[model samples]
Target: MLTGKQKRFLRAEAHHLNPIFQVGKGGVNDALIKHIKEAIEVRELMKIRILDNCEEDKHEVAEALAKGARAELVQLIGLTVVLYKESRDNKRIELPKSK
Candidate 1:
């Protein structure tokens, strides 16, 4: 679990990033989860865009993606979802100390 401060910091850090992936009409799948898990291991922070064609609820998709990737869901604004995870080999983006 991430502390509130850590999430805020990550949100700021991800503000300028573009969505690297998109969830469309197909919705979340194992392949998507696998890719996200693999990517998060290196990038630590990323954003995913949910397109208007998607059938699932935005929140459900966000939860599924976060759970599947074993990452923290930092924020879900508009149609974008921000995710964060501690990189195992290529660690970056030092988070704020949790109180």
Candidate 2:
């Protein structure tokens, strides 16, 4: 779990990043989850965009992706969702220490 400061820090770090994945009408699936897990292992932080054509709610899509990839949901603004996870082998981000 991330503290408030940690989440804020992550959100700021992710501000300039582009969404690497898009969730469309098909919604979340096993293949998407698998790919997300692999990507998150390397990127640590990533953004996913929920397209206008998507059938599910943005919040639900964000939750599913975060849960599926076992990553923290940092922020969901507009159509984009930011996620973070401590990489096991390819760790990069250094989160702020909790108080």
Candidate 3:
């Protein structure tokens, strides 16, 4: 879960990034989730794009991905999504301490 401030920071960090992955007509599969989880562990933050041909709504896809990967949905804009998860071992982005 992200606070508003944290989400804002992540959105800015992800703004210039291209989609590292795409959810196509097939939608979010278990295998896809596993791979995405790995990528998130490494990259910390990444962009995902929903294909124009996708029949399911964008929020549905974002929710599915978040639920599948146990990650945070930082933002959803147009067809894009930003996801984040702190790696226990490979931890990267050090968030500001919250009192």
Q: Largest lDDT belongs to which candidate?
A: 1
Residues 1-57, candidate 1: write the lDDT tens digits: 998888889999999999999999999999999999998898999999999999999
Candidate 2 lDDT, 1-99, residue by residue in tens: 999999999999999999999999999999999999999999999999999999999999999999999999999999999999999999788988898
Question: What's the lDDT for residue 99 in model 1?
Answer: 75
Q: Write the per-residue lDDT of candidate 3 for residues 31-86, one digit (tens) a residue.
A: 88999999998988899999998889899999999888889999999999999999
Screening candidate 1 with a backbone cut-off below 3 angstroms (N, C-alpha, C), the clashing residue pairs are none
TM-score of structure candidate 2: 0.97
Query: Which portions of model 1 show Cα errors greater than 4 Å?
Result: none
Deviation of model 3 at 64, angstroms:
0.3
Global Cα lDDT for candidate 2: 0.94
Q: Which regions of candidate 3 deviate over 4 angstroms?
A: none
All candidates: TM-score: 0.97, 0.97, 0.93
lDDT (CA) for every model shown?
0.95, 0.94, 0.89
| Winner on lDDT (1 vs 3) | 1
Instruction: Kindly state the number of residue pairs that clash in model 3.
Output: 0
User: Rank by lDDT, descending?
Assistant: 1, 2, 3
